[model samples]
Target: MIKDMQDLRKLAYNRQLVSNNRLVLPEQVSALESYRVLEKPIYELIIDDLKTTSWTVDELSRRYGIAKEDIREPLLIAMRDPVLVAEGFVPRRVGRAQRNGKGSNVQYTLLPIPIEARIFDITLGLSLLHFDTLLVQHVDQLQFIPHDEGLDAFREIVAEYWSIRGDKVDQFISKQDVNCVLSALGPLFIPNDGGIYDRIRNKLFEEEKLLVPRFTRKKINKDIKKIRRKFSEGFFDLTDVHSTVIALSDLTRFCKYSNRMSEHAELLKISEDFFYSLFIQVHETVPVPASDADALTNDISEVSIGAGQSGTRDKEGTTAMSWEAPKCPVDGTIAEFYTVITSETAKITEKQNALRCLRKHLHAPGVFDLAICSLTTSANTNIQKEAIKLLAQLGDERAVEPLINVYGRVGATLSVEVIHALGSIGSHEAVPFLLEVLDQKRFENRIAAIKALGQIRDPRAVPVLIRCLLEPKGEIQRCATIALGDIGDTVAGPALIKLLHNPRSVIRVEAIRALVKLKYTEAIPVLQQLLGGDRSKAVRDEAVRSLKSLSMV
Candidate 1:
C-alpha cells in the first residue's frame, strides 16, 4: 500500500526489518525500467496474491488467461532470479504427478523477480525466445524410455510436428498444457503415481519417451476406450487424432493409489484406449522414417546402460558392489564449494569448505557472511570484509551488528557493497553506521550510506535524513532528497520544501522530486512556486514533471 516513493523510502528507513533499496542501485533501477515490458504486466497480475501466498499453476493460468504450461517457463526463470522474487513476485506448482519410482512432474512456484535478473530477461527476451525454437528443432537429441508403446507415441508426435512433410510444432506451448493432459489420464493406467508421471512428462517435454502400458489386449482396449471417450468429450481439444495420441502417450504416468469405484477405473480405461487409437492414427499419417525396420532396434537399445562398470563394497564387508558416484570432471573442491554455497543439497564437509573459502575472500565487508569470529577479536579486517560481502548474498540479519562494527575497516568498494548489503539484510543495527556514514564528508560513501538507509525503509532514518537535507553539497543533498522521497515520509515534507527555493537548480529539482514521492498535498504551493517562479526553466520543467508523476500516483 505504499502509495508513493516518499512513503516507500520512509518505510524502508523506519521499518525494524532491513531490506535493499532497489531505487539506489542504478543498475537495478535501470534494469527494472528496461524490463518493464515483461515484468510490469506479470507483476500486476500476480503481485497482490504473491505477497501473502503461493499460486498454483492452474489458478495462475486461469487468472492470467495463459496456459498453465506457458506460465511455468517464465515463472521458473523468474524464481531462479532472486531480485525479482524479493519484490513480492513468486510462482507455485499446482498438482503433484502421482508417485511411482522416479519423481513428480516439474512444477513451478511463483515468487518475486529481483531487479537485476528482471533486466536480463527483458533485455534478452528475443535471444531467450530463440532457445525454445532450438529446443523444438533439436527435440530428436533427447533420449526417452519406452513404456506402453511410449517410444512409438513419442516418435509419432515428433514426426508429425517436426518431420520434413508434417506441420512444424513451432508455436511455443507451456509445461502446464502437458501437465493437464497427464493429470487427467492418471486414472487409466496409473492411479496416483507422481514419480512415474514426472519421468513420462520429462520424456515428452524433452521429446524423448512415452508412457505406453504393458497389458493384455482386452485391458489395453479398455484403457484406450476410456481415453478416447475423454478425447471425444473435448478432454484434450486436439484437431488431429495423432496429436492427441502423442499427448496421451506422453501423459501416461504411473498410478500408485486406486479409485475405490470401478466406475472411475472404467472411465480412466476408456480415456487411455481413446488416446491409443488417436496416437496410432497420427503415427500413420505422419512421414515415418524411411526405414521402419529399425523400430525393433530402437526398442532394444532404449534401455542400454552407459559404459564404466563395477566395484563391490558395503559396510557389511561382503562382496558388496560399489556403484559409480556422480562426479564433475572439473575441480572436486569447486563441486564441494557449490554444494556448500547452494545450501540446498550438500553434506556438512562441503559447507565447511565453502565457509572457509568465503572467510578467506573477505576483502569487501558485505552481507554474505565472509567474516569469521575466531573468539579473539572482531576487527579481523580482511576476513570481516569478505564476510560482509557473503552476508549480503545470504541476506541474513544475524550479520548486521558485526557488519556495523566492521564498517571502518574497508575501502570504498567494500564500503559501498557493504552498505547495500546491510540494506538488503534489513537490520536495525545498521542504522547507526548508516547515520555515521551520512555524517562523513565524502560524497560517494555518504551517498551509498544514504541509499542503503533508503532501501532499508526504516522510519528511524527520517530525523537523520532530515538533518542531511540541511547540508549544502548538491550531491549529498540530492541523495538525501531522493532517499527522502523513496522513504515517503510526510514528516520530511517541510524540510524538502525548504530546498525548493535553494539557489542550486539540482537541489531545487530534487526537492520537488522528494515532495512528489512523499505525496504531500501541502507541497502543491511549493511546487507551484518552483514551477512558475523558479529562475531556471529546466528547474521549472523538472518541477512540472514531478507534479505529473505525483498526479498519476
Candidate 2:
C-alpha cells in the first residue's frame, strides 16, 4: 500500500488510449484542474465513503469496489489531509497519516467541496442570465412570422450595440458568451417566467403599439411559462423548448434554482406576480415627458414650502432621517435663504448652492411643493439635480408622492437620483415607484433602485433584493449582498448562504459580510466550512470574522 511517498512512486501510472496516442499523467491531466475531478460523481462516492469517519483499506475496497492497489493512494489521501483532498490531490506527498493497518477499523472522513472553490468549479460558471439573453435574441431573430418594425428595431438595437463595441452579429457565441452578456448587463438578470418574460413580451408589444400603426399589434403571444421553465431545466437546445424557448441558451440560471420559490418568499415583492420585466424591450426612445415647464408653472402658487411655523418635522430613527444643521450661502436667516432659491435671475451655481444650504435650513414643512416644484422645473440641469437631492433630504413622508409622480418624467440621470432619494426617505409610499424602477430596463438605474430598497430596509423588499443576487453582473450581486446585510433580516439567511458557493470570490466575500450582519445561526456550518476549506486567505479570514460574530451573538 502507498503508506508513504516511496510506495506511491512504485505504483504504475493510470493510462488511457486517446486516438492511438497513449495519454500519460502530467501530459493530458496537467492541463486540467483538481476541482474538475472533484465535481464528478466518482468524487462524490469517494467523499461519501471516507468523509467524517475513517475506514481500513480492506473495508474501503469492499465499500467502493476498488482494487487493493487503487485504494492505496486514496487511503494515503484520507489520512494526511482528508478535508482538502476533494479540492484536488497529488499522489506525491503522503504527509504523516496513520497506516492503513496500523490500527483496527482505520477511518477517513471526506469534506465536501464548496461550490465557490477558486478552481475546479464546473457548475454554472456564469449566471444562466448571460446565456438566456443570447438565446432570447437568437429566438427573436429566428421569428419569421413577425418580421415587423418592432422586431426589426429590436434587432437594430442589438446590432447597433454590437457594432458600437465592434462585435460581429454573425460571430458564433460560445459557452462563455453568456458571461459577457451578464457583465454588460450588471451582476444578474433573474429569469422568472411569470414576471420577467411577460414583461419582455409587453416591451416588444408596446414598441409595436406606440410607434407603428396600432394595427401592427397583430402577433400572438407565445407561452413564457413554458419557455422559462424549460430554460430553468437547463434546456439549451432552442428547438427543444417549443420554438426557441431554450434556443442556444441556458448556460446558467441566475441565483440558485429551487423546486420551491417559497424558500425565498421574502425576496418577492408585493404585486410582482404579473409585473413587466426590467430592460426587456429594445425601444430607442423612452418618451420622457417633454420638459417640466407646464407642470412647474401651474403648481408654484399652491406649493409654498415653510408655510407654517409649526409644520411637521421628519420622524427620526432610520438612517436617512437625520438632517444637517441649516446653512445659508446667501446670508443671515430663513428669509434670505428662501429669496435666493426663489430668485429667477440667480446663477445656476448660486441656486444650486442655495438649494444645498436650504436642504438643512428649511425646517418648516407643510406643503413644501413650492420649493420642490421650483427645483424640479428649473431649466438648468444642475438646479434640477440639486433640487431632487434637497427634496429627499427634506425628510418628510409627503415627498414620497411627488417623487413617485416625477419618476419617469425626468431625464434618466435625474430619474435615478429621484429613486435614490426615495429610498433615503424610507417610506412605504415610495415602494411602488421603487418597484417600477426595478422592473424597467437599464441596470444602472436598477442598481440605484436596489440601493434605495436596501436603505429603506422594508421587509417587502427582501424578496426583490434576493432576486438581484441572480443577476449576471458580479458588482450588482455585490451590491445586493451589501443591501441584504443592511436589511439584517434572517429570512434572507439561506439566500445569502447560497452565495457563499458562487464562483466569484468578491461576491462570495460580500455574501459573507452580509451574512455576518444578519447574525444568521443557520450559516454556522457553512461558515465553518469556508473557514477551514476556502482557498483564498481573505475569504477564510472573512469566514473567521463572521464565525466570531455569530458565536458572540
Candidate 3:
C-alpha cells in the first residue's frame, strides 16, 4: 500500500513518465495530507505486515516489539477512515479464531484495490490532465474499462469532459464485456441512486445480463431442465442459487425474444416452480424481506415469461390452464395438510390454506415443527403471518426461540407478527428479546413489542413498561397503560393510577381500565373523583366503570 505523500507522488510520477498515463489525481494527493496517520512508522509497519496476510493487533504488537495499546487506535483509525478507503490504503477487517478457541480476534488484511475503483482513479486522472479526447478515442484499446460503480462514474466523467453521450459509449462496448465486468464485480455492488441517475441505473440494470451469460437456446433449454431436476432432487447448491435463478430467467427471456416460447413449454412450467422454490430457499437462508423476494420473482416472470402465462399456450398465446385448488385428503388429517404445505408444486394460496387448516391440530405431532419451518421459510407474507398466528395459537413454549430468531431476521411487518406470536405464546423466554425490542427507536416495532410484552404478562417487563408510560408520545403511553393492565402486576398499579391526571383523557381512560383490571381498590377514591369532576365524558365514564369494579372487589 502507498503509505505517504512521497509514495503517492512517486507512483503518479512513474505512471506519467514510464506508462505515459496519469493514474492519480492532484486532489487525491491533497486529501492524503489531512490523514497524517499515514506518515506514522507504525502505520507503515502495520500495512506491510498485513500485505501478505492478516494479523491481529496482538500479533502485530509482538512482531514490532511495541505495546498493543500504542498501535491499536491508529490501526483502528486507518481501518475506518473514508479517505483511506477511497485512496485504497485501508485494510479489510476480518475475524480469526483465537489461540484458545474461545472467540475470534479482529485481524487486519490488506486487499488489492478493486479494479472498478482503480479504473475510476485512472479515468479521473487522465480526464483532469486534458486527455479526455485521447481516452475516448482509445477507449477500446484500454485493457481495463470501468464497470458497475466505476462504470457509472467513468461514464459521467467522460460525458462531462469528453462530451460523448452515454448511449453512444454503450454502442462501442459489447454486451459480453459488460456482463464480464459485472460478474467480476460480484453481488457486492449495491446501488444507491436518485433522480436521473436512479432512472439511468435502473434502465441499465434491466438491460444488462445477470452474472449468467447467454447460451444457445438449445444449451439454455438443457441447463434449465438440469437445474429443475437438481432442485427437485434437493441437490442444488445454495451458493449458486442466485446465478442459477438468474440463468433460468435469462433463458425465459431468450425464449421470448427468439419466438421459441412454443418450443419451450416445459421451460415455463419448470421456471415457475423453480422461482418459487428459490424464493423459499432465499427467505429461509437469507435475511431478505418478503416483499423484495416477491419483487424478484415478479420481475423475472414479467420481464421474461410474461405475467399470467403459466399454462399451456393457446393459438392466440393466452393461458389455457384452469385454476384449481389442490385436493385435500378425505380424512383432512394433519399429515395431509403438511404434505400440501411442504409440497414445492402447491400454489401459494393452497399452502396458506393448508397452514390455516393446521390450526385445529396445533398440538399434533410435528405440527409445531412445520409451523416453525413455514414461519422461517415461506416467502409469501400471508403464509408466514398465518404460520405465526398458528404458532401463537399453539402456545408451545418451545416455539419461543424460533420466534425470537425470526423476529430478529425478518422485516418490520413480519417482525410485528412474530412479536404478537411471542406475546400470545406467553413464554418468559421471549421477555428479554421483547425488552430489547422495546429499547429500539422504531415506533411501530416498539409499540408492537410493548403490546406483545403485555400479552406475555412477564413481571420483568413491568418496570420497562412503566418507564415507557413516561414517554412523551401518547400512543406509547396508552399502549403501556393497557399492557400494564394485561400484565396485572400490582407493582404497576401506582404508575397506572398516576396516569389518571394526565392531560389526555384517552390516557386517563386507559389508566382507569388498567386499574380496574389490576383490582387496585386504592384508586377507588381517585376514580370516584374523576367520575364526578373529569372534563371529558369518556374519562368520567371509564372512571365510573373502574370504580364499580374496584368497589365490588
In terms of lDDT, which candidate is strongest?
3
Worst 10 residues of 1 by lDDT: 179-188
TM-scores for all candidates: the values are: 0.34, 0.43, 0.41
lDDT per residue (tens digit) for residues 502-543 in model 1: 887778887887788788877776776664355455676787
| Candidate 2, residue 39: how far the Cα is off, in Å | 30
Order the candidate numbers by TM-score, best to worst.
2, 3, 1
Off by over 4 Å in 2: 1-332, 360-370
Q: Candidate 1 — which residues are off by over 4 angstroms? A: 1-335, 338-387, 411-413, 440-443, 549-553
Residue-level lDDT of model 2, residues 120-178, one tens digit each, is: 11112212123234335444322121112122222333443223121332132211222
Task: Give Cα-based local distance difference scores for all models.
Answer: 0.45, 0.47, 0.57
> RMSD of candidate 2 to the true fold?
19.9
Please give the TM-score that candidate 3 achieves against the real structure.
Answer: 0.41
Model 2 gets an lDDT of 0.47
Clashes of each: 102, 30, 0
lDDT of model number 1: 0.45
